[model samples]
Structure formats: structure tokens, C-alpha cells
Target: MKILLSTLAFISLAVLLGLLTGGRLSWLVRNTTALRLAWLAPLALIFQWVFFELPGMDRHDLVFAGHLLTYALILPFIWANRRMPGMPVLAAGLGLNLLVILLNGGMPVDPGLLRAIGRVGVYQDLASRGWSGNAVALTDRTLLPFLGDWLVLPEPFPARGPYSVGDLLIYAGGFWLLAGLTRRPAETEAPLKPA
Candidate 1:
């Protein structure tokens, strides 16, 4: 899917940048605190699996699987950096997403956008085939507030996909916190050795 391709591109870019910088990349998750606290990411994902689900199997299930796998890989880094400064922010973001998901009946999709993406046929097929036999139908209008509406930005430049404001904020905050956590703390000077 396009989302998966975009994610792979992002990860490739991050790794390429890390290599080019001779391992000086601040967001590389090389420090102890970051590695340790990463556990929370996976744990949060597990919560998603336990809590979010429709009646039967659906394509949306891939979202939870992606989160679980991503955090699983990052867990070692978080565990190593358990004392890092950014865990709180990470936790907060996770909480926000969880809250929105819980409030939105397990999935955070925008039906309008889903329709725009031409998935109405798929949804109709699913319903007709009883794939979502027990699941309730949802519409964008039914979702609350502007924030609850999954409004994706139009592509700002050629070759780039759309992104939401929240996505930008989350990405910025994540990188900033990761950078701060990975950099080695400045060493204090020993009161010049007595001559």
C-alpha cells in the first residue's frame, strides 16, 4: 500500500542519514535511556490489540499489526534508554492516539477520505459478504469535531504524499526528543588536577 511504501522510504532515509553521519545521527537510538523506554511503545501497541477490534477480520487490522511490529523492533532501544528524557512525550503521544481510537470505535479512519480513496466499493463488498457482520457502519459526519475528522493535507509538493498537521507535530516531537535523548551528556570538568 501507499502508506507502507511511504514508511519504508522514511525509514530508508533515516538509516541513510545515520550512516552518512558516521553514527553521529542524534535520533539513532544509540543511548541507554532511549533504548529502555522504547518498551512503552510496544506495550502501548499491545494495548491496542487487546482493545481495538471490529466484529470479524478486516483490512484495518493491518494498522495494529504495523504498530506492534514497529514498536517491537524499537523496544530494545527504549529498554536501553529507560532513563531518557523523552519517554514522557512518547507516552503522551501514545495516550492521545489511544484516546482518539477508543473514542472512535477502535479505528480512526475518515469515511469521506476513505470514499475519496475509492474504498466504498470495498466496504460495500465487505458488508454484502458479511465480512463485517456484527460491526456498525461509520461515517465521517458522525465523527466529532474538526480534530476527530481525519483530514489529510493535500500534497504540498510533487512526489510527496499528503500528511496531517497532527502527523507533522508528532514526527517533529518524536525526532526532537529522540535527538535530545541520544546525544551524550556533557562531561563535567574535574577541578584541574592539583599541580
Candidate 2:
């Protein structure tokens, strides 16, 4: 839920930046449609939804495989679009997430970060029970704890949650990419020079 909210918030900001910069929504639409391997994104989301959102899926033994598969599916589309503005940042973020997930078996969650974000109950539950959904509580055994979901947006912020440094980078890249699209075509694309 927080991930979805964070994504929406970043996209909203990007759209606002686009309009403020006199960028056409039509351009965003057209450019996005032209992206290569775009279908992979929706397919990945659907894959995640099937594994995590469908009723009784939480109990399925393959939930872990589904979680890891989500990353595998997303990385390729990001790679295919690597030359796009801000895609490198997005790729770095996704890469960091994939690293931590691969190392730790899932995204690690810091109970302290959760508490700081007004999720004490959730923190306590995780602290006691040790695992929930695709996230595992950050503990001494957690490798590369620094890469875990230690970031937080506290109260009064419309969008708030336990996110990782990687997640922030992903959102920032999305914002940059969308906002960059609003620039005049000439500014976005350099004139070809004779070699």
C-alpha cells in the first residue's frame, strides 16, 4: 500500500512539474507509449498482484519465488530504457533493491524506522513475529542493514511509510525523467554534430 502511494505521489509531482514547465501531457503520453518493452512493466505488476494481493496468496509456498520474480521482471524493462533521461538513477535504485533482496531473501524492515513513522503496533508485531509479507525484520543477522528500508516520512505528510534509500532513488528518477520530458524538444535532444 505504501509503495503504491509513494509511486502515485512521485508521479503526481512529476506531472505538476511537467505542467509548470509548459510540457505537454501529450508528449508524456506519446513518449511513454513509444517505450520499448513497456508491456513488461504491467506484466510484472500483475505478477506481483497475483502473488501478494490475491486472497490466500500470503499462505502460498511460492510467495517467495513470486517476490523475487518481480525484480527479475522489472530490471529488464529498466535496462531496455537505460538511455532515457534519469533511467540510470532508476536502474541504480532497482539494482540496490535487487541486491538487498537477493542477499537477505526479501526487503529488510527496521522496526525502529517503523516506530518513528507512527507504526508502533506494526513494529511490535514484526519485532515479535519476525516476518510479514515480503519483508523481514531487520536484525543482527540482516546483511547490509544500511540498504534496508530504514527511511521514513512521518506524520502530516500525505505520503508516508518505511522505504529504503533505493526506493527514494527510484522515485527521484521517475520525477526527473517525467519533468525532463516537459522541456522543449530541442533542449531535451541535442543537435547532431558532424564527427
Candidate 3:
């Protein structure tokens, strides 16, 4: 339910911004490639949610798939749009995550944090099913060098929310990229006549 609301809010915000920015929505829609990729995000998001919520499913597998979709597919798509400013930053952030993943074997989840967050049942289930410890654990110590590990972030206010440094970097990169892409390029000024 929260996911759905968040998704709707994102869409609404995008549309509102598009309208305010002289109808970029139509321009984006006219670009078939961009349009297709834009649509794909929501679909991928739905699949991700389903994979995580389905009963008797291996969460590690789903988590891996989610990361693969982002790193392998979505990142490439963003790269293909390299003419857009800020793509480089997004690519760099993705590369960092990819490096961590490669170094740490699959996803890097901290087991202790998972236990703290009431995810022990899910972790136990995945572990029993032969998932790698890095894939299902929930500890900062365990996940730091891994790709998925970068997704977990501890809350700033000491509340009970876990997030990763990678997540922060990703968000910052993504926002920067989006802002760059959405900005209108400056128009060239004609030479001034002699006064």
C-alpha cells in the first residue's frame, strides 16, 4: 500500500513538473525510446514488489533480480541517453555499486540489522534455501563492500530505519542527473550592436 502511494505520488509529481516546464511530458512521450523506458520503470517496480511480497519465495533471488534490473538494464538505458547532462554521475554511482557487488559475491545484506528489523524470518527462510549470507544478512559490517549492501542506510536521527551510504549516493546522483536532464539549455546571445 505504501509502495503504491509512493509510486502514484512520483507519477503525479513528474506530471505536474512536466506541465510547469512547458509540456516536457509530450516531448518525452514523442520520443518512443524514452517513452518505452519510462513506462518500463513502473512495470519493473511492480514486479519487484511482487517478488518481495510473494509467500514461500526466496527473497535473495528477488533482491538479486531487482539489482540486476537496475544495474544491467536501467543503467544501460540511462547511459544510452548520454547526451543528457548528469548521465556521467549516474553511471559513476551505478559503477560503484557494481564494483561492490562484484567484490562481495552477490548482494550484501547485514544479518544483524535484518534481525533487528524483524526480517529474521525472511533471512532464515532464504538462508535455509541456500542463499548466500551476503545476500540475506542485515549488518553494516557484512554489507559494506557488496552491491546490495550499499542499499541499506542507517537512519540519521537514530530512529529505527536502515539505509546505506550507497543509497544516499545513488539518490544524490539520480537527482543531479534528473535536474540536468530537465533543464533547458541556454540560448546563444546575438552580438550587441556598437553603442
Give the candidate number with the greatest lDDT: 2
Number of backbone-clashing residue pairs for each candidate, in the order shown:
18, 0, 13
Span of 10 residues, lowest total lDDT, candidate 2:
186-195
Ten-residue stretch with the least lDDT total in model 1: 186-195
- What's the candidate order when arranged by decreasing lDDT? 2, 3, 1
Predicted structure with the largest TM-score when compared to the true one:
2
Across 1-195, the per-residue lDDT of candidate 2 in tens digits comes to: 766776787788997888787888776766666666888888998998888667665442366689888888988888777767788898889888878978887789987777777777667867876655667789899999888888767576655767798988888887887786665545443321211
User: Which is superior by lDDT, 2 or 3?
Assistant: 2
TM-score of each: 0.49, 0.83, 0.56
Q: Per-residue CA lDDT of candidate 1, range 115-175, in tens?
A: 5645575356434532231122344443433323254545542223223343454555455
Count clashing pairs, candidate 3: 13
- Stretches of candidate 1 off by over 4 Å are 12-29, 32-34, 37-87, 118-144, 156-169, 178-182, 185-195
Q: Which stretches of candidate 3 lie over 4 Å from their true place?
A: 4-56, 59-70, 126-134, 138-161, 185-195
Model 2 scores a C-alpha lDDT of 0.76
Q: What is the C-alpha RMSD of each candidate to the true structure, in Å?
A: 8.4, 4.1, 8.0
Candidate 3 residue lDDT tens string, 27-115: 43333233224554456556655555655554565566665664555654654554444455656666766666655545556555566
